[model samples]
Target: MTDSSSSPITVRYTCPHCDAVHSIDRAPDLADRSVTKHSQPGWEYATPDDDLEVRETADGIAFICGEDGPVTDLEGKQIEGCGRPFYLNFVRFEQGVELDPNPATYGGPRFDFNG
Candidate 1:
């Protein structure tokens, strides 16, 4: 069964040659857009010659190099310059709550005058 409590909020890039994996965390809703922009010039410096393949499943997305054999990211495409097939996988989720900071005393309970 899938974990409905939370959704994947990160993308992991794994290099086939070097076996190195890089993880990028983002808001769950923004993951798709973030992955798509990686191929853009200003976003990741990927050249038109660089073959980029993207696959999306119900859970997440994957980006792989279409070229045969090993590939290198010497241009710093947000990944290490590893000579191998580059794979980007997004499948892990983090569950948590974001709360605003309180300015009350450190050891005291919060109080509301309106209450």
Candidate 2:
């Protein structure tokens, strides 16, 4: 079998406001570990943490952009992007990987409602 950890999964995201493109390489093993953290007790119902840049959701991973941008290149230059945060939804089967359809908005204003 091949080592999935050694292979870096490339995830490319396009800015919604601008046409600038951004790409990131994520380790499968690390991504899995981050996603697994979402399952901890009270994690789902917890409030959003502003300090977190990257967070895992029930469906996939979210890339929270800062005031500067999302990621930088090998030369330490920030990639050209609109700086708008986005998400990549994972379409998984059993234990293997599949396709990521498109990037979605990362976050927005939250409101509490009582029924």
Quantify all predictions' global Cα lDDT against the true fold: 0.36, 0.40
- Please state the error at residue 75 of candidate 2 in Å: 17
In angstroms, give how far residue 67 of model 2 lies from its true place. 5.1
Question: Please, what are the lDDT tens digits per residue for candidate 2 over residues 24-115?
Answer: 55445433322221223322221123222233223444544433245554454666554455444443333576432222112533555899
Q: Model 1 over residues 1-115: C-alpha lDDT tens digits?
A: 3234555464444444453444544335442322221222212232223322222222233334433223334443543333333423233343754222233212446777984
Measured on C-alpha atoms, candidate 2 has an lDDT of 0.40
lDDT accuracy of residue 93 in candidate 1? 40
> Which is the leading candidate under TM-score?
2
Clashing residue pairs, candidate 2? Answer: none
Q: What TM-score, to 2 decimals, does candidate 1 have?
A: 0.23
Q: Where is model 1 poorest over a 10-residue stretch in terms of lDDT?
A: 33-42
Model 2, residue 2: what's the lDDT?
22
